[model samples]
Target chain A: MNKQTYFKKFKNIKYPISRRGLLISFMFYSFFHFSRKLYANGEIGGPFRDRFQSFRQTFRVEPNPEEAKRIINNIIKGRDKRNNLILLNAPDIAENGNVVPINFSVNCSMNGNDYPKVVHILVLDNPFPEIAKFFFSNQSGSADLAIRIRMRQSSEVVAIAEMADGTVGEDRFFVDVTIGACS
Target chain B: MARKNYRRRLKAPLTAKKGEVITIKTMAEHTMEPGVRRDPKTGLIYPRFIIDSVIVRYNGKQIFRSRWYSGVSENPYMSFKIKVEESGLLEIEWIDDYKQSTFKRSVINVLDNNGNEIFPIRLSEPSQSENLQ
Candidate 1:
């Protein structure tokens, strides 16, 4: 039957709603109303945007481990697999941790059909752990990047590349800092 | 704004083979006070003045961007790669905590193996450079 005829025929029939059904929906709405629909990283709506906010202001005083946990959790975002698409380069034994190089690249054809939508680098132990977050459009040409970051102590660094298909690749490397950098 | 007259040096090649990945290194000499340190002279907290963001764009398309914290070393050095596409102008913008911005631009030449322009020349190499002269 056509959708129009089906709707017209159904409109003539009235079914009484049960009180239990109404109560369940009201409870469901109230439960979610207390919680904001957001990811761990505060991605409120839409694809990831290259929005910049004050990182220091997010947590005051000493480098709070709890705050870093929230930030790194947002970076990982429950993605699966430590794939080979991302290459993370770091010195196994950094003579000076003050300027350790945290470099990485995503393997993908920078075509409109598929590309890394965002690339994030996180240092697990820095006072401000998030080192870099890069948003890549098709015009980015390539996915490779290199930069210097400071590490306060021996810690694991993670690089995750989020592709347009909603899947992500992760890579982790460790740096042995001889002397602390973030004091 | 960062210290007045702070200089930015971009050490990179003006030309690259098309599709070849090349490393572009940049460094800016400026003091990045994190605001936690108390000035010896005043015995008070020094206001933070830091270059918080660095963005690199080529042919008007942004390629790489990063947020730098105060923990980043002084004279911040950033090195990264770009897959050489069509040649155009490469611009670097440095933004600080004080809303001050510094801009440096370079003419990128994406040439084929042969000495030919792979893309239309947008800007020439720096005229005063000893290499070009």
Candidate 2:
């Protein structure tokens, strides 16, 4: 059976349908239409019928918890192990959110398969959850970095270290922002 | 289009011991616009303008790299560590979204035991002249 023969056979075959079957299918379609109208009118989904719209606009806001979770999940994939391998140092209170000084160091010797390949920084409440990513080589003695980042509000800063080996670790710190930055 | 002048700065220890880790700090002036702010009068959104990546190379070999998003504050400052095996030229490059790249370089002299500077290439050896047959 070649593809052309199969297509010719399908074209020759007829799907037999009775008048009663057509009438039943029309009724089913009408039922679906009515249900759709009810859903649009907020009667089907009850109080949370507008959740879909809210979900669509989830990435627009600064404090988007769902989007942050999605970004973390995408980064870590299935390897979600939290350990002390990564130490994230961030201020407990930042007077100005425009520049929050933060640093991170990985507890790994720069030996064969002990160093970190990439380290990710994420601000859970920022509009863009992923703040930065650092890539280190063996010549990079220490997997440590210090930088300044902007935060829209007080949020948990997460640092995830993906080691050269198949291991991953993360650390989180909460910082309170007295004045948030508009980004 | 007229481009704005961006100031770049790089600092590293001028001298260090062999097999020692040294810290390097780099700073670049950039607006780092997040593209979400609106103008007060025109209500126009500003386009995103930021440094996309930073690469650190020692003796022309890359040792460290970083990718920055708009979350990085204006005039970004970053510091990291690298192990020096020999004296070499260190370069830090900043690449922005506009495909413009700016780099700052510094030379470090690595000293071994007995306070002797180590050079990547032999300075005392002379090259042999090519012989034609």
Candidate 3:
């Protein structure tokens, strides 16, 4: 049947007001309300919740082992193997936190077949831990990169590299900051 | 609006041979504000301050460009390598999000394999040596 005719047929139909109908209608309304409540609560646990949690954890000035593991697992999920990745962390005593130099090198063949696809660097302790993402092609020649990053406090830096073979490699470095970046 | 007290220094060798990769390092002084902090006295959030882009030109030809972010620390420092093909003017310009800008220029002279000057150029302003000549 056409959609218009289907709707028109039901538009005027009225069922008798019986106990069974009332109970079924009540159950349907209750289910709808319950689902709405569940959805509203789930909104608090959305993807951005991890970002908010990271911000809060930085301010609390406390070490969170669970949060650290979550970050590691996320990195592992995005890594690709067949590329040699090296992650270098800044020295523990950073004279200046504002412009800490971080260097990364990948021992990849750099050939069209085994080139590195992407390099992602993250500072797990920073307000925004996703520091930088670099896309490299064969034109890059070498997979060595150097960049400066800001850190609020001493934290661990993680580097993940994805290779052409669909394998993942990772390295981590711990940095100590004598001077905070915020200052 | 407050007067910013920052400076940048870019250094590279004045001469290189053709097809030689030269390392250039630049250090700039500026506060890279992340805009996430509130002033204790005024309770006002500071606007983000960062060097947004840098471009290097060789004789009016674009050679290198970089995009920066707040993740880069204050008083930013960057180092990169570029190949010198011939004698030309090397110009570097830095621009910040606040619309403040600065430019630094250097003359690059390419030498031959035998260390003989193939292209001679001077970048500094007329000095005592030039005055004597």
* Model 3: colliding residue pairs: A79-A168, A80-A167, A80-A168, A81-A167, A81-A168, A92-A176, A98-B73
- Against the reference, the lDDT scores of all candidates come to 0.71, 0.82, 0.67
Model 2 per-residue lDDT tens digits across residues A1-183:
898998898677767976799999999999988987776555655322222321222123446688677667666779858568999999999999999999999998899999999898988888767788899999999988899999989989999898988788989999999998876
Instruction: Enumerate the chain B TM-scores of all models.
Output: 0.82, 0.87, 0.80
Give the per-residue lDDT digits (tens) of candidate 3, residues B1-133. 3456357788989988887767777888777766676788997777666677777777786755655655677667766566666777888888877667788888888888888765534445478468868
Question: On residues A90-182, what C-alpha lDDT tens digit does candidate 3 reach at each position?
Answer: 666787787788887777666666765766677777655555555555534466667788887887888878676777788888888878776
Isolated chain A TM-score, each model: 0.63, 0.66, 0.60
Model 1, C-alpha of B53: deviation from truth (Å):
2.0
Output the number of the TM-score-best candidate. 2
**Candidate 1: tens digits of C-alpha lDDT, residues B68-96:** 66556667777766777678888999987
Residue pairs with clashing backbones, model 1: none
**Candidate 2 stretches greater than 4 Å from native:** A1-62, A80-82, B1-5, B123-133
Q: TM-score, each model?
A: 0.69, 0.77, 0.59
- In candidate 2, the residue pairs with backbone N, CA or C atoms under 3 Å apart (3 or more residues apart, or in different chains) clash, namely none
lDDT of 2 at B63: 87
lDDT accuracy of residue A118 in candidate 2: 88
The per-candidate count of clashes, in order, stands at 0, 0, 7
Better of 1 and 2 by lDDT: 2
Which structure among the candidates has the greatest DockQ?
Answer: 2
Against the true structure, candidate 2 reaches a TM-score of 0.77
Comparing 1 with 3 on DockQ, the higher-scoring candidate is 1
